[model samples]
Target: MELDRHGLLSLYKTMTTIRHFEERGIPETGQRGMSASVHSSAGQEAVPTGMCANLSDDDYIGSTHRGHGHCIAKGVDPKLMMAELFGRATGPNKGKGGSMHISDMSKGMLGTNGVVGASIPLAVGAALTAKVKKNGKVAVAFFGDGASSQGVLHESMNLASIWKLPVIFLCENNGYAMSTPSEYGVSTTHVSDRAQGYDMPGINVDGMDVFAVYDASAQAVARARAGEGPTLIEAQTYRYYGHTVFDNPLTYRSQEEEDHWRARDPLKQFRDVVIPQGDITAEELDRLDAEAEALMEEAVKFADESPLPAPVELYDDVYVDYPVDMMKRGVNMSV
Candidate 1:
């Protein structure tokens, strides 16, 4: 877990990229402009960026609704992701699956789910595939504190443990599950504590620190590849915005609480900890910031200029095959 200068620089740049992308995209959700619902991963950038830093393109990751960071960290092109959000034909799913369901199989992103706790089972399935194939790849499922209560999560955990599937259950404990806090919904003291029931190693981490997440994930990934069972990691973080872009968190939580987390802003902490210590210079960090902002600006322009799905192509990507006559009707029936 010894850090190199290059590794620290990549972490800093990736976290900044995720934060900037979410900031630009999620703000368009007020009904005045954007096409789809946006769930911001503003404050929680460190978790995915750090975890995914240890992943390869062949390693699978299942993500939550607020998964722009996960996608970016998993080596997906943000331009394509932004295009998907804009609902353009050039998008990842050609505008069919928007913010909630964006995916890139080539990069091993299973897909971001709109249904809470849904990705856990999917990640287990992906890990099962890897295990059966004997591929040296591990699957990671990124869920929130709310998903910790779902039956599917436990079932997935149990199955993975019994089969010794190469999977990692990562819970981003951001305090609240929508308007309701984790204290209100979850009976467990911490989400990682539930891992004991499934006989897996449970770890609690500071999601605000990228290095911590990377180190823990590296160990879990090594264990899985070595034919060991799954591990559950609960990252203690906070969401800077409301649950969704439309909801105002002020009604449920105090500004003081929000301000407290803001003071520990992951991006700022990275700079403060690394720059003065000489791991990275301010000039290099600024260059990365400029590059990220410029990249996002280009993604917006590319999305704006891209075309929408054509009428005759409605059946495209819908199914493997269908009756010629049924498809010729230019209608969508198979939901």
Candidate 2:
């Protein structure tokens, strides 16, 4: 698929944003000894960027633990996201929610959770609400191959297909679900094949190729919007990092495997394809890299200086209404 100038630039910007943020943000948050670890999507950038290109700000997205890519693709602010990762008072969830639980409801980012496959049902429920209200909004669930084994995901798919809900199930098949290979954990060779049981359209796409993923996800998004039904998309991509900061990848996969995937990096592929096609120049891409780096630096500074949440905030944002005296104690009732 030949992307227009705007589309190419948007793809480049989003992929770069995810890369830079993961490269820097993870270490910054980890170094503070916050006991926080990020499952960085270092190499698997194209799938989320391409898939999210088919969505609007009003469309809902539920993300996985390694979700910085999805968040950036869905138009999340790097500053606020960095703040949330840093657990600062100025974060999107007032620092209450960390990396695995960041959410921006106004932007249609329902939330990310640590529990594997939890977001699938959440996305289905959101899609059910949209369908019932006839809102014309689609809900997306971004999960990893590891999540495919979770029972909730299958239940959600059954419910979604039965109701013909406006939801897209995207499985980022990054070879391994933690330390276990997809071949070992999953029964099917292609995750999309499992969609047959639910009677929905199933598609398997080359996730490393942005255009391919874009075309596939665009079709699924269009189908959902037209009230056709849900679509299950399995994007075969690879991540360049260990499951978390603590895991030694050498225990499961070799340096050669990591290096092999890194050699076919998504950003490099996009540059090779788009730059030669007259859509953008190398210098323009470099400028974008510089701008993204600067933006990240500013975000880090903001997070470093921000205050921790107040003691009283522990009981806040949990419910629509709080205790009467707690609200009267200047608890910022304007939520």
Candidate 3:
């Protein structure tokens, strides 16, 4: 799939935005003394950027814990996401759903799941809705290699295949599922190889290369939109940080391994490919990098200035019609 200049630039912009958001937001969590678990997707920007590039605001996407990239790529506002992480009332979930659960229904981003492989069934259900309505929309399920082993994934795939649901089963195989390496957990050499059992096309691509991921996802998305059932895509990628913010990756993986993946960073790889073609310049990329940094700075400011959710409204979203007076009375009730 050949992308025009505008498409190429957009891809670069989205990837940079995700990278900057993760880089800036993770530290802010620590500074705020937030106990919420944040799984950084710094090294896996290309996977979401490429996949979501093929989707529209109406297309649905179910995300995993390491889903900041997925949210940004799917067009969720970074400032609102930052506010959510900061536990502000202005957040998409009104400060209730933190890092792992951040969701924006307006952008068609189904909530990011904290459970392994949980997003798979959600995406399948969305696809079934699209198929029933004949809405011409597709859904995507983003999961990690660790979640690939979950029974829900296999069950979703089988049902999607039989029902011909318009969904893409995307696996961001970041070498490790938490601390356990893919080789130790997955029986197959590539996770995509498992697609055979479900009678779907399995594709494995270079997750670090945005172009490769974009091309593969373009085909898979097209297939789904054409009512050809689901496609399984395994992106061979790596994560720079640990499973969560507090975990240290060095304990399980070597510094050399981390350095190897960092060298092939998605942003750098995009530059290496585009600059040589003479259509896009290094200065242009640098400008985009600067803009992304500035954007994140503004997002941080927005989050910092935002107010926390009021204590009395705790049950507002939880109950459809809970009485306000009951909330006030409950607030004063002794335990």
Candidate 4:
């Protein structure tokens, strides 16, 4: 919880990198004609950086569709992420999977999926694997408030508690699930309350406060690594953009609400704390910001020049082994 100068610098760098990457990466991807519009993690930058700050590269993390921050915090190369967003062969998924499917397993980033809440069970499964192997690793699932409605989330929580899996369910509750306010869809006001049903510990955190998220996640991680069961953490946060870029939009939320959240941005809060408490200089922070901007520019260039996937690769990664039922049904193999 007490961040040394080095840790604070790293935290600032990560949050800034994530914020810049999403801001620039999405537009560039659109310009390049990637079919799917991005689902951004604009105002919710701290949840990933703070949670992953306490984790090692060996620890596993499963991220949702709005996952650019998780990827950056988990040590994914910005160039590769940008390449994936741009749908270039130089991407982490070799241009096969776009933003929603970006992954770097070597860095313990399982994957990001378009389907909401799917990562919850995947992370719990990874936690169980870590437990069985006695690897002293913990798995974290980064999901959204909307994802809490999925049936699988509850199932995953119940199983993690019953088996004492080393997992953390992090719900980034940004007030709304797409256009619907969370209060309208959710039965409970606090998403963390769901953990009580499975008899596991739960904590609610200010998602915009990077240090608070870091401190709270540290406790949950420590308990998990000590063989305690999973913990549910609901982080209250906001997003500045629509669910995706292609949305018909125009009437869901107000500009005032967006402005309110922007004023309380996590990166700004981190800067305020570090400048006073950690002896960080604004000039130094500006240097880091410039570096982030430069790196992202290079990433865009790399993605722009990278090759596209070969046509033959369409059926290559379909399955480790083609299913017998699939063959029996005589389904069309080409995608």
In each prediction, how many residue pairs overlap at the backbone (N, C-alpha, C within less than 3 A)?
A: 0, 0, 0, 0
TM-score result, candidate 1: 0.95
The lDDT for every candidate, in the order shown, is: 0.89, 0.90, 0.94, 0.89
TM agreement with the true structure for every prediction: 0.95, 0.95, 0.96, 0.94
In the range 154-242, model 1's lDDT, one tens digit per residue, is 99999999999999999999999998899888898899999999999999999998878888899988888998989999999999998
Per-residue lDDT for 1-335 in model 4, tens only? 78888898899899899989988999888887885657888889899999999899999999998998999999999999998887777889987778898899999999998899998899999999999999999999999999999999999999999999999999999988889889988899799999899898889999999999999999999999999889999999998788887664347888788888989999889878778864889888998989999999998888888888876566566788985456435665554
TM-score of 3: 0.96
Weakest 10 consecutive residues of candidate 2 by summed lDDT: 326-335
Residues 173-220, model 2: lDDT tens digits? 999988999999999988999999999999999888888899999899
The per-prediction CA RMSD against the true structure, in angstroms, equals 2.2, 3.4, 1.7, 2.5
lDDT of 1 at 111: 97
Residue 164 Cα positional deviation in candidate 2, in Å, after optimal superposition:
0.5
Better of 1 and 3 by lDDT: 3
lDDT of 3 by residue, 1-335 (tens): 78999999999999999999999998997799874489999999999999999999999999999999999999999999999999999999999988999899999999998998998999999999999999999999999999999999999999999999999999999989889999999999999999999999999999999989999999999999999999999999999999888889999999999999999999999999899999999999899999999999999999999999887557677677777676667456432
| Candidate 1 Cα outliers beyond 4 Å, as residue runs | 29-32, 327-335
TM-score computed on alpha carbons, candidate 2: 0.95
